[model samples]
Target: MKSLMQDVPLTLDVVLRRCLETGVGVEVVSATPAGTVRTTWGEIGRRATALTGVLDGLGVPAGGRVATFAWNTHRHVELFLGVPCAGRVVHGVNVRLTDDEILYQLRNAGDEVLFVDASLTDRLAELADRLPVRAVVVLDDGAPVNPVFADAPRYDALVEAVRETELVPRAKPDDAAWICYTSGTTGMPKGVVSSHLACVVHSLSSMTVDSHAVSREDVLLTVTPLFHVNAWGLAYTSALANAKLVLPGRDASGAHLAELIEAEHVTVGAAVPTVWVDLVGQPHRMDSMRRVLCGGAPATRSLLDAIARRGWAFHKGWGMTEMLPSGTMQVQPPDLDLDSPAGAITRVGKPSAGVRVRLVGPDGQVLPWDGRTTGELETSGPWVIRAYLDPDDDSNDTRFHDGWLRTGDLAVIHPDATVEIVDRVKDVIKSGGEWISSLALEQALAAHPGVAEVAVVAIPDDKWGERPAAAVVAADGLAPCAEELVKFLAERVPRWWLPERIVQVDALPLTTIGKPDKKALRARLSSPSRS
Candidate 1:
């Protein structure tokens, strides 16, 4: 009988002292390159307590690892609340990877203190002498500094030389705050980490009114990429819902996020689905947004009917980066049919609360969520990732098993537990033995009105040992015709899932985070002159 309450500690300094006592005058803005700046949540909680006295005068220790590589500004939301409320850990990094994946994630997260982003100091001055980082700082954004970080040190003069030092929070809701990594698209990128009670319970389960409800009269924006996964956490649920955050630095174009969501009347934006297909083809006035969220991929029901013809409210989520980036969220189930193509509007819905989700099969059994039983989705609770920070790594024997988290997608689940993902156990395709689904043939050829972008991928078919090959990209003056997108996927999928080759291209080799690389389109459709 160990009852009597009061166990406190879920840290990030209690979401930075409740966003500095209730968002003291809200607004955080930042479109920098020496431009929009702004700042508030009580001056970013006194510049994140002067960035924890510039990470304790750059010594950084207590669980170390800082690293930022900037962009989603307001000084990367003050190193996402001064490096995990000064107990230290932050990590972010991604800045569109490769420079050998940013020196293999700064030597696999031994990070230390790198900050950066004066227009990314000549790509971090060629890995600032192979960074195991101890002090680089920068952040300036008016560009022009990289004389190999001309004697480094200048995140606003080291937070104005520790702006009257006070630095309190020493963290500990199971410490190690945020590390992120995995866009290695099925390979190298690993490191997950999280905790500070799993980022304050995934920012109070993303302000739950069915997740991503995010409040304080919402105004968010984060075109996802505060070095990736955490941006998907919507910058800590817009600083624990004291909302109004914005930051579009490094122009996430589509007419600069439709003029920064119509000059910041931005009521909740989040990104991906290729930045909402370049903000549904630019040209402005965002009518104060009102819900967009989307996640790394799968949105195309003609980009959710071109973001429901701009009345916004898209919401397709489903996560990873080991699930600290969210687990599932599509919430629009009122007897479903948001223009049905087998509705549940691109289902990624159920399982956000403490996240459980199952569906195993291919013999390990545990399937039946019934909605036509496809399998391989597994997941598990309180902000997921129970492994992968290399403990004798072997990708923990194929991405963990007994404690769930295999999530190589390939979903379905439905009998009210919603889900529906449909492929990526290395992008599924089997063919003559019948499996198919390269994301349900790239969502039925992205609902073909002359397909703007698609992907599919699974080639090698001398007797159906594996068929399904697409690639597309048209829409804009339409030329569509690979037998009219296989007769528009022969009335939607399963004529042995169509496409034995479609091609078209003009762009669709993405993944530096904008996904759709399909392993570089199955090595450019298995070569020999694009097969």
Candidate 2:
């Protein structure tokens, strides 16, 4: 009964070689500190081969960790190929982490070779002595003089001096390929290790019609940082599809991204909803864009309509670091009437193939997908992490049950498998023994013409256990009153969900990754000046 089929190993080298073979002429453009640089996939492949030789010369052991603290530039892309293809784990450290967090990740990962950006030399030099790194490779045109890393080598010297030859050894599919840490919003950051097979499957699964819909003809302008969740897995998908990549290094501002999208003729762009908010009202020509992939937070109805007016579709995705960053994507059925005002704010769509999703109640019972019973969302898939890196770390115990990851996201699943995220488990407002969704309230407020940004948090109330309060940031050229906003919400949502107080502020506090820092807002509301 055995059917014979040729067995092939799924590793990073498979895609790296495929890119060179099929996409040798595709352009990889990047805006670097020096200036705009352009290179072909063939040239990058050759350079990456040379870099692999350099890493070998540096005595990088097989399965050793090589860390990169850089932006999404062409050089970083090379590290994406060189390190993993050379059988070394690519540990991408988030550059925006706090000084102490940066130190902790570098030391905890036990990274051997530190490949840092030139701009971060001073920061790395401060903690280079404490890390287990044996060599420092500055990823720049020339090595800068620093007493702490004076002996470090420059990226250009090492690559150019080495011979152009493939040094990749045969690797197993289960070999560790990359490591990226969580945002550490609550506790110390935890590492998520992705194997070669996991990433290969994720990359292939992501480009399907229901997911990102990537192809060779698509030009992707990735606004997400490479250090965070594999830049939403754009790196691997682009290579797999032989698509053109445009990297906007360091400067992800509205104006800069607008210019790059136009200049590069970017057809598809991916970033969080906050970035889209910044670009929506700004003067930018986004006519070339066909679709925008938004994640990290849900997109408001206003934002979606604004993008639709420009003839571009807006998509919402829901995921975390543990799921290889892609769990669900927004896809409306043809029968659904999305043109209606009520249907404008779309839900996070069904899970992709090979992923199983369910909602569980507080009593450990599975909730039905009836679109009414709200519960904690849990997911399990080939790409999802079954456990954290540390064997004895029980701090995240409540985060997992059996083998599924407890997403800590409060959501309702429809009969069609589509999910509408109501709130985070910690951010949901509990008032009078009824649950109030802060995200739902925020979405309603954001639809107001004058309300530009809004974040709702639960504040202490004597009558109810807690009441919802809003931190409003007005839109440009318009100032809205609290009474008008309250009336606006009264028409849309239940009167009980309306905020008792609305505090106008210049801007909402944002996390390092540009998410609304609700934790800080809660602390501020507890203070006397705000209370």
- Every model's TM-score: 0.34, 0.94
Worst 10 residues of 1 by lDDT: 333-342
Overall lDDT per candidate, in order of appearance: 0.80, 0.83
Per-residue accuracy of model 1 over 137-175 as CA lDDT, tens digit each: 787878788798888878888787664745576888887
Q: What is the lDDT of candidate 2?
A: 0.83
| Model 2: ten consecutive residues of lowest lDDT | 333-342
User: Model 2, 1-531: lDDT tens per residue?
Assistant: 986987768887777886778879898998887889998777777777676688788898888888998888888988877788888888999888887888788787778888988867877777776766788888882335456766778897888998667646546888888899887778788989898888889989889988988889989998898888888888789888998999998888888999998889999888988888887676887778887888887676667767767777666788999998899988533233455632545378889877899999999999999988989999999899887776666745867987889999999899989887888998889999998989889988988988878899998888899999899888888879999999999999999999988888888888777788888898887567884
The residue pairs that clash in candidate 2, if any, are none
